[model samples]
Target: MTTISALPLLDGTSIPALGLGVYKVDDTTARNSVTTALEAGYRLVDTASFYRNERGVGRALKDSGVLRDDVYVTTKLWNDAHGRGKTRRAFKDSVKRLNTAPDLYLIHWPCPARGLYAETWRALVELRDDGRVRSIGVSNFQRHHLETIIEDSGEVPVLNQIELHPYLQQRELRAFHAEHRIVTQAWSPLGRGAVLADETIVAIAAAHRVSPAQVILRWHLDLGVAVIPKSVTPDRIRANLDVNGFALTPDDHDRIAALDRGARVGSHPDEVK
Candidate 1:
């Protein structure tokens, strides 16, 4: 089994750097996948209320026999729940479905069009203060959105989850995160499988005798970004966590970095709101 290391938070909390993502995975598959991941030594599981599988993830955690404090669970509040009042209620509902308190809670999207994320962020801060969640963060937030929240809430988020891969290097945003002491978390570290067939990544994988997926994951790890790659298959779940053994060389890292095309597969934070 793989023994993944943990990354420290700004608050001195430790989170497993590699986690199992449960996006688009249904209840049955989520249960099996999360259970398999836990058994394979993964202590972190990422899910969202939008994914509609929190109940299954909850079930798997309970059945896996792992102590709640032993695993790091993360979930997000949806766009519609971006108000102070609604944000509070949303977290309660999510916790009910999760059957456990999440180690980290995030605002799923900035949803600036609705003009309520600042209020939502305030609510998250309240949640953290009230002991409902250990940490609070934002997802899909660009640097500007992050600035808005920081300005309004007067508290920096612990993480900013975004779409990051070899093709879409978010250098400027990452720099801002680092400057502010916020950790950058990669939502689609594999480029949604697009980079798996790339000649550069494939060549690297061949040289390392690893799969293309493992190669991409290793790149994220070397970059110091937390990654949550989702897979319903048991083999893929195990494979995703088996990324700690290999180290990418500096030359290999530069080769992958040059593959950046600035392409993003997900919706822009500004467009979504």
Candidate 2:
């Protein structure tokens, strides 16, 4: 079993540095995957309203025999619910579906053109205040979006989930996050598995005798970036969390750094709206 460590968030709560992401997966698969992951020692499970599988995750968590408080659950508010009323209602629906309050709740996207993320941010703050969510954060937000929310609400998010991988390292945004004491969580941390077969990553994996996915995830861990790599395969789900054994070398970091081509496998934040 991997000894997953925790990263302290801005709100004085801690998050698991590596976790399972249930994006694009259906309910049955998400349920099975979450159950298997928990049985395999994974403590964090990431889901979202857009994923439409929160019920499955909730079911698995309840059935997994793991204490609810022992696992860190994160769910997101969808783009359509970017206002106080809808956001609150969406959160309530999510809680009912999950059968419990989430440990961390995030705004799925900034939707800047909608000009209502600030309202959604206030809703999240109120959720935190109401004890519906332990910590609140945002996903797919740029620095400007982050600043806007903080300026209006006087509250900074605990973390920011972004599309990050060796091929699309958001160095500037990462620096901004570091400066602001915001933990950077990587969605699509493997570049949607595009980086799994890269020559450099493969070479490192060969040296370490681990899967290329594990190598990339280990790289994220080394960089202090929290990762939620999505997979429905039981074996791959187990392999993704089996990354606490090895350490990447300086040369490995340089090789992976050289692979940064500013590529993205997900939508650009500014263009999402």
lDDT of 1 by residue, 16-83 (tens): 88999999889888999999999999999999999999999999999999898899999999998889
For 1-273, candidate 2 gives per-residue lDDT tens digits of: 778899999888899999999999999999999999999889999999999999999999999999999999999999998899999999999999999899999999999889999999999999999887899999999999999999999999999999999999999999999999999999999999799889999999999998999999999999999999988888999999989778889999999999999998888888886
- Where model 2 places Cα greater than 4 Å from the true spot, the runs are none
TM-score against truth, every candidate: 0.98, 0.98
TM-score of 1: 0.98
Q: Give the whole-model CA lDDT for all candidates, comma-separated.
A: 0.92, 0.93
Among residues 3 or more apart in sequence or in different chains, the pairs in candidate 2 whose N, CA or C atoms overlap within 3 Å are none
How displaced is residue 136 in candidate 1, in Å? 0.6
Candidate of highest lDDT: 2
| TM-score of candidate 2 on Cα atoms, chains taken together | 0.98
